[model samples]
Each structure stands twice: as C-alpha cells, then as structure tokens.
Target: MRFGGFKRLRRFSTSRRLWVALVLLALLAAVLLLQQRSEPPDEDSGNGYAGLGEDAMEYAQAEPSHSLQFPGDHGPHPDYRIEWWYLTANLEDENGEPLGIQWTLFRQALASPDDEDDDSDSPWSTDQLWMAHAALSTPQDHWFDERFARGRPGPDQQGQAGVTTEPFSAWLDDWQLMSRDRDSGDLDSLSVTARGIDDDNTFGYRLDLTAEGPLVLHGVDGFSQKTADGQGSFYYSQPFYRVEGQVEIDGEMRNVSGRAWLDREWSSQIMGPAQQGWDWFSLHLADGYKLMAFRLRGGGEDGGDYLSGSWISPDGNVTNLDDDAIELIPTEHSEIEDREIPTQWRLRLPGQDLDVTVKARHPDRWLDTVFPYWEGDVTVEGSHSGIGFLEMTGY
Candidate 1:
C-alpha cells in the first residue's frame, strides 16, 4: 500500500498556500509518527537495515569509473535510489563532561525518475521522501527525535525538504546544516543546528565546523566496494572538522569544543541479500591519525564477514585496506533495550602496526527512531589514545 494520507493531499495544492503547507505536514505525520516506536525488522526479514539491501536494477548504479566532483556532488542525486548527509560529533562541555551528537538527513526515491508520470505537474506531486534524525547523548541518557517530509525537485517548486549546493544547505523544517560562507565550495566550513525531544527532556546543539585537513575519499577514489559481488557506493568524508559550539540538554546549555566528522555516500545497491547488517567506526587518534573501517556480516568471500577500511595520515593521506589487512573482534557486549550490542571492540591494523581497543563511553546510546540502531561516543586506547564514534546495526 502507498502512504496512508498522501492520496488526499494532491487535490489541496490549488488552495491557499498556508493550507497546502499544513496539509503536507499532516500527511507526513500520518505516515511516520505512528511508526516511531515500531520494532526493527527481523534478521531474516527484509534485505537489510531499512531494506537497504533491496535490488535497484532500474535506477542509476554507482560505477567505479564514475568520478565524483565537488560542489555539484554536494547536492541531491535524484536519479539514485538512496542518499544521505550524515554528521557526528564528539564534544566535551565546559565542565569536561563528554557528550555526543548526531544529525542525519536521508533521501529516498519513491519511484525512479524514468518511471515518473509526465502529467505530474502539480507542486504536490512527490516522488521523493525525506527523513531527518537528531540526537544527543550524555553519560546517563540519550535524547533523540525524527522528522519526515515529502518533496520532488523541479523548476517550479522548492519542496519543504530539499538540499542546494551553491552555498551547501540541507534542511527539513527548522533543523538545518548549512555552509557558513555563502561562497563556500567543497563544504569546508559549515554550521549545524537541530532540537529533539526525548520523553520530557529536550536537547539540541548549534555548532560551527572548520576543516583542518582535506576531504578523504574511500575505496577507489570514491567508489567504496561493499560486497564480494562488487556492490558498492560513492563514499567520501571530511573527518577533520574542528567544532566549537554550545549544546542544550533539558534547558541547560553548556559551551563545548571538540572534533566532528561528516560522511557523504550514495548508492543504488550497497549490499546483497546475504548481508545482514554492519559495524562501522570512525576514530580520531591522539597522535594525529584517523581510521575509518567497517565489517559487513555475511557479505564476504565465502559467506563470512566483509572487511575494508582507510588508514588516514595526519595530512589527510589515505591508505585503503582490504579484508586481509584489517581485523575486528567484539570483546564485550552490553545488554540494553532487550538487545545485546557489542559496546567494546578490539581493532587491529597489522599493516600500520596499529592495535586499539575501542569502547563506548556509555552503553545507553541507542537511537529509538523509525530505523533503530546503536550509535555513541567511543574511546580509543592500547597503542593509541583518542575518541570517536561507533555505529552498529542488525542487532
């Protein structure tokens, strides 16, 4: 079945503009708000997390030879089935209390552009669905919220949810991550703000991010291979963001400063049906080094786990590592919300003489959104020292 309340919204576009906007919001609320606390799909249910493993043969594929460009690539790729602009930060308040923040805007095509109806000229004609998630995590609690909207890009319309690249702005309602410099390119400087409510406590942040190094590309220039069958995505990141800002939790605001990371990736098909979920990490080491790595369970050569990563130097140089070069082992687990999640991990990169234990600062950093997952701040120790973020999906 289609969205519950959207079929009736198309007829109201010719009415007053204010009424049209309200109807659009009401439609989104009907579709998503009810699913806020739903359970995640079963392990053997859909393809993968949020059906990301579903086949998309009709849409544009992320080819290895397809080179990625700046400024233009910063905007939405409507021809693709899925894309996201994700940012995560590790911050410390004035009192040295550590906290974490995550802001993400995701875009999914309801139908391929080739399949769009030629007669669909109304501003309400939508072929794209947008969702945003914002969260803040403290030592004892995690606050998170989700928002949804519907839009389609065309000459005559700027939908309620969309992104533009000239100055780099992404938003769904009041929550936004925008470029500070109006003439900025390559997303070197940015400011992000969002407010979310958890139970009765409200939380959010406003931060300015400045790049200290260059943007790093993963896999072959930007085509990150995801499976043994050659499925992958166009992936790159600005992991050098130096952040200065303030965060508010439960009406209490505190000055904070630390590092942040922004990840940009788009793909038609990122995983095969055999792949369940993934465990990913992005770490900023103490002695001026960074590492990005992930393990895709059941997507490897013989139905094992697929592993790949990038070992980045201080100056933003990247050394891509294949499965044989990197190792990840879960040494501890945390039982929370009726699930056992691995909260501590032992990561070893033999090629770089690097071995580190990555442990979550707290085990309560579970995001209870439409698509649930575990994400939180992590500490790096053993042959290295620093902090970063960890994300785990599919249990």
Candidate 2:
C-alpha cells in the first residue's frame, strides 16, 4: 500500500462538508446489522439474489458455490461488494530473533450498500474503491503503512485494482504483489513490493517469496457462509511462503527472511448491519499444521457474530470449521492509539480437542497508521508452541 500527502488549505468548502456527511452515513449504515432489525416495508428479506430486489438483480441467484478454478480465481470478482488479498508472515532473521509482516489490499463496492437497485452512470462510475495496509514488527519496534485508491473497470486505464496471471502480477501501482520473472506465472519466485510515506517516517519493502506448501481453500466448494442465515463469501489461502527480502526503514535497507501467509476472499454481502468488526488470526504451528480463524463481532448481545477457520495438516489437507466449532476469547486488553485491544487470547477448537493460549511477541506491534490496528507476530503455547500472526481490525 502507498501513503501520500495531499496539499491542505486552512478553509472548509461546501464540497468538503458533503464528503464528511457521506462518510458519516456510510459508517452509520455499516453499524446497522440488518439481521436483527426489522426490514422496511419495501425491502426484500430473502437470502437469494431476489431478496436484494431490482438493485442487484444482475448477480446470479445460485446455490452456495462449490467449484473454484485457480489462476483465474486469483483475479477480481467485481460484482462482489468486498474483496481482499491479505498476507501475513512470521519470520526470523540470521540471529533467530522473531519478526512479523502483513500486507493486504481491500476492495469495497460502494454502490451496493443494501443491494438496492440504483442506476447510476458507467459501471466504472460505480462507487467502488480500494484500500490497502502493510506492516512490519520486531521485538524492539513496529512499522505500519496504509493506502487508498479509486477503482476503475477497464484496461485502458489501470483499474485502481487488478490481478493478472500471464506474467503473474497483481497490484495497484507503486504498491504491489508481482512476479519477478514478468513472464512466468509462478508465484514462488514473485516479488512483493510496497511503499508508504508518512509525517513520522517513510517505509517500504520488496520481498521475494517462495511457496513451501500448497494452496488451501476454505469452506464447502469455496462458498464460506459467515452468518447463521447463510450470508457468506468465497475464501482461500497460500500459507506456506518462505520469504527472503529487504525492508527499508527510513532510508536504510535491512535484509530479512521469514514465513508468510496469503489470504484472498470476496463477497457481495458478507457482514450484516450489526457486525462492527473482526479479530483474525493466522498461526504457523510448530507441529506442522497452520491455523486460520476469524470472528465477526456484531454489536450488543441481541445479534450473534460468526466464526470460521481452516486447519491445515502437515501434509496440506484442509479441514473447514463451522461456526460452533471455533472460539477465541480475549484474556487481556492493552491500550493503543487510545483504544483497547485484546493482546492475549485463548483459542479453542472443540472437534479437534485443541485449546491454546496466544500472546503477542511484544505489545508494541500496534500499527498507528490510517485505519490503525494491532497486527503483529504472536506466539502460541499450551497445546502447541508455535509462532503466528494476529490481526484485529475495526476496533
């Protein structure tokens, strides 16, 4: 992700006020988990595309998805309301000291707020936008970055977001995840480069990643339902990356090598109005299995949040997790950026008879950038002693 500074004026204008109003409205709309509240008289309440009424009629009303094709699957699904390519890594330098890294690109379709049919201009005119965040952390310090862009659909103009297979490149300008060969679509030899400049500092990185394991998909046939009513998304991951790269802190280059995980998911409507944020984890277990889990936390007790995960066996078999199957409880909270974040967690998997305690490798891994959050390297003990990445967003 890239971070840039725009020139600022001392005065406010009518247009600025309107922009502020739009942002507030969007935030309010997100907080209204539609599941628990009664729909308006004119609204459609079914789980199918028909329930979305004429607004989103173009989307197919098919049953939960099952088949997923690769190469093509790595690209965008514009019809979806949201999509992202998230990567995290747990690594150690030559000294064996631990370090962690994260890079993610998020796409949010602004036009389909409630799946209502609202005809605007060109499909490119649709209000879709993109945002990205990247971070790096060591026991002694933490570094973070954030970037935002507008989305376009066609090739003449670089869509603010895209993923290509021919040369195996995926990126959104200066900030990108691309193949080094520029000819081979092999991801094992690809390079991930991202740069960001902020008032406090300027940071960037370019890393070479080689896959150590196979790619894993979550849920049944690629459709991962996140809510009780079957609201869900398509999700998959590549979690066995052996990375050797360099990160530029301020103006110095530091060589680093580590393990990395990449996650990609897309959905037309994933979260209900009540859902506010999420706590996500990607652990690289010492026992050979990798664990990926997330909890969608809705507001208050009246509405229920959702949880799902994948348990990757050493040999690369992926087991999908149901809502009732996984649990992550906050054992302690630390104040960062004037916000309380759970720094320690108790993770439980009932069916596998697994229970583990995870603690931050250090508490200061919090990224204090736009869309600030705590996403850093962590260590898991109890049932298994291993290293992993923890990501807590929206809170």
The alpha-carbon RMSD values of the candidates against the true structure, listed in the order shown, are 6.5, 6.5
lDDT of 1 by residue, 57-144 (tens): 4679998999989888888898898899999999989889998999999887766667644346675666677878898888887888
Q: How many backbone clashes does candidate 1 have?
A: 0
lDDT of all predictions: 0.82, 0.68
> How many steric clashes between backbone atoms does each model show?
0, 6
What TM-score does structure 2 among the candidates reach? Answer: 0.79
Model 1 lowest lDDT segment of ten: 1-10
Model 2: lDDT to the true structure? 0.68
Off by over 4 Å in 2: 1-63, 112-127, 153-161, 298-304, 368-370
The alpha-carbon deviation from the true structure for residue 362 of candidate 2, after best TM-score superposition, in angstroms, is 2.9
Residue-by-residue lDDT tens digits, candidate 2, 161-264: 56677667667666788777876765656678887654466677888888877888787777776666666678888888889988877897787887888887
